[model samples]
Target: MRRNDHVILGQERSMSRCTRVWAKFFAFGALCAPLFPVPPAAAQTPAQGLTAAQMREDLAVLGQTWARKDRSFTPEGRERFELALRRTTTQVEGMHPHDFALEVARLAALSGNGHSAAHLPAMPSLPVRLWWFDDGLFVVSARADHAGLVGAKIERIGRASPEEALQRVSQFIPGNDAHRKVESTPFLTNPRALERAGISPGAETVALTVRDRSGTRRQVELHADAEPARGHTWEVLLPEAMDAPGRWVHVLDALQVRPAAFRSETDLEYEWLSSEPRVLYLRSNRIYSVDEVRLDLKLFEMTMKELVDSAPQAVIVDLRYNMGGNYLNTILFAQALPELVAAGGKVLVLTGPVTFSAALVTAAMLEMHGDERVLFMGEVMGDEPRFWAEGDLVQLPHSGIEVRYSDYFHDWGNPCREAACLWATRIFGPKRPISLAPDVRVPTTFADYARGADAVLTAALALALDADVGCAAQRVRGAQAARLATPAGRACVAR
Candidate 1:
């Protein structure tokens, strides 16, 4: 999209508590606190069961709210939802609250939009935290009592193989396959989720088959915590940041150095990687602006000015850990990049399963505006380019679980023209098609992670170093011409 001036009618809703907690857990790479603290008396009291009528009423409200507000809702999704509802209604009398919540979550996932979900209450989790690496699912962290399990590869959970468990758990997550993988980590740690997914019997303890670094295979029984652990949709912790001392022990705690990508905790940060080549590295951990966090417009402007002044031959924008915020904050930054590095330079965007929502939008914007110079490297993004977002949450009456719905549509696969753009004109202008696939795909492997190596960053840096820095003659043709037709385009060409 090319626009000189832009206006946004409204701000995106703040990250839901579930999302916020996930962001914190991943960003900090440690267990901080319980998601929702319960009073001592409340913790001691058992959960009151709900009647079939109350559960049905909650489901009805959830369906009605989604039908009314979610613009992305489709006939196929609605039909499937109704069918599931009918089947579940008949069985609610015998179902537990946790099982009912999973059913509701599965209903929300039917929309196929990442933002749509049923945010269930925190559930008890096994002491160990598992992460899916390129090789397989492995334990990255564990409560002090189960520290021996850390770094062991998971072969099976109860009777189900790791692959089968992942497939079963995928039903409760929304969005594309990539997003499902990103959001399934926390759910995999929950014993209730494991039981619902048919990976284990509903019990306080679950058996796991694991192989340690020594290559010895053994079955380990893990018990769930007494208190419910806070869970979020996205929870990938950086291996290097596992050093923070807490109730949990991380496998990589002995490592002394943190990789460049995990070095900063700020929402936005930039530094010069090489003075001779004039390579600049910018990492945006979050997309929103909050003055209290030093992630405001002023910081953004200053960063952009430095980028322009540096005249870097190559720039790397890392969004692997960004779960999203306000994409509008980076519109001007995206628009200015094509010309900024058009002359024999490159713009590299790093994305992964956690690069979602507004973070995905930022990468799309870079690809749309920077054209051929913009290279995407790393794993697939959390969501598809064309997806639904910008909505609010509705809490179910009896269960109190929050179900989120999407009210706006954003298409990066096709240009946004006239009515195709659902939001107000003030918020967006004519947008161009953006391809989200990586030019170079680099998956993070457990071997690299265990040793404190960043294969993705290494590959991107190598590509940047090998790239030719001369402007192509055909730069002003087709899409380039269309971009150059605008004032920003003319300015870019003049530079």
Candidate 2:
């Protein structure tokens, strides 16, 4: 079913922080002009093929039924969503199921929100896992059957080169940044996505040209495998002594993180990643309570107390693995973060590609009020400002393809953001998200993974060296420590 990949919490050691992120991550793009690939006439099967009429009906229902019900699609995103559905319905008549699903994904992502997705019905992926990084796609993980190809750089998939394949896939990946392409492409490392994009000739297998880790070039006869359902994790690293080793994982990539069981996130956990410059690390793996842990609403106040009492050199809150259970988690934290900034601590919010939804809201809130002391360093976030979100799943009666529609319109404090006309980005080939302007963009590459780099944390500490936390401690609080007030915080409040 179509989904804006809200991942189940899972564990994997990647770029080292023993990360506990929740989502299926990593993907690239493809080059399907018009978004729909032209399926060959002879490729159609009465059993698996969808008719233009059926597609038209689905599109009609999208506007007349689902959109009407999802109401979040109205006022701004409604017309654009309907127009995309209309165009795809006309184009889908002669397409096969995979191709049709591809178009549906694009139409859903066109809503310009991560919470809304046009997902194809679930299918098993190929045995090997393909990764998208700053350079391009690579084989990061493989089942024993295809173990020989692990770490190979994928250059082509069947008929199309990697660049072409990624462009075609990009349109359907929800979110408006290059980071979304990387986070979403792993789900498409299958034969169907390739065939549907007109990049592969069939549904069962595809020819993958890859440059092996040793620099040898080869074509892998990759075949479909019943991919196991992925799992999630919620873990916490206890506070460490000032000179203790960091909890960051130096080995393993994203998929390699396999925590056997979940951990309790009922309380907030803080650690000291470094003592030389004194970086206090806080990991917020989940936003709400789960069966395994006690959900603590006062955790934010406790964290603030900890920050004030300990008086560390800098505060690093790790929200990369946080998959949003409560927006209130963000609200509470946002209300108090200015204290850290006011205390002259360098506050670095360490985020990853999967930092999403309520977690994004939290980050946005911190930035909105966290003053100059705050600096974000990592990949572009999973969601964006002015996007459709808070959704429910809907399935088509005929195709059974599931789609998630937005339930609410979130402003994220950006009045200039217009969700209806949002343009999603794909970092495939030359077209990248020009708007993904992180203060410091760190690359989580395979090479970086191999060297066991906690790139985000590393970037943070490195940035800390340049910051003068000492000078600010001299009590120049009122004059030099003023925050850059966002439009949301600038206006007068009514009693």
Per-residue lDDT, model 2, residue 240, is 17
lDDT score, candidate 2: 0.53
Q: Tens digits of per-residue lDDT for model 2 on 1-495? A: 111111222221122221111111210111211111111111112237567778777667666666665644445666787777767766775677666666667777665666676655555567666556667776655654566776788887888777778777676776666445654454457577677667788778878888987899988786776543122211111111225332222114332321111122422455444434445556665665444322333343344344555556676666766656555434546656656543566778766666776676667666666656677777777666556555566776566666777655555544333444222211111121123236777766667554334556556655554533322221111111122132321221100
Error of 2 at 444 (Å): 2.0
Q: Top model by TM-score, which number?
A: 1
lDDT, model 1: 0.67
- Candidate 1: stretches off by over 4 Å: 1-47, 230-246, 290-299, 417-420, 424-432, 467-495
> What are the models' TM-scores?
0.80, 0.67
lDDT to native, each model: 0.67, 0.53
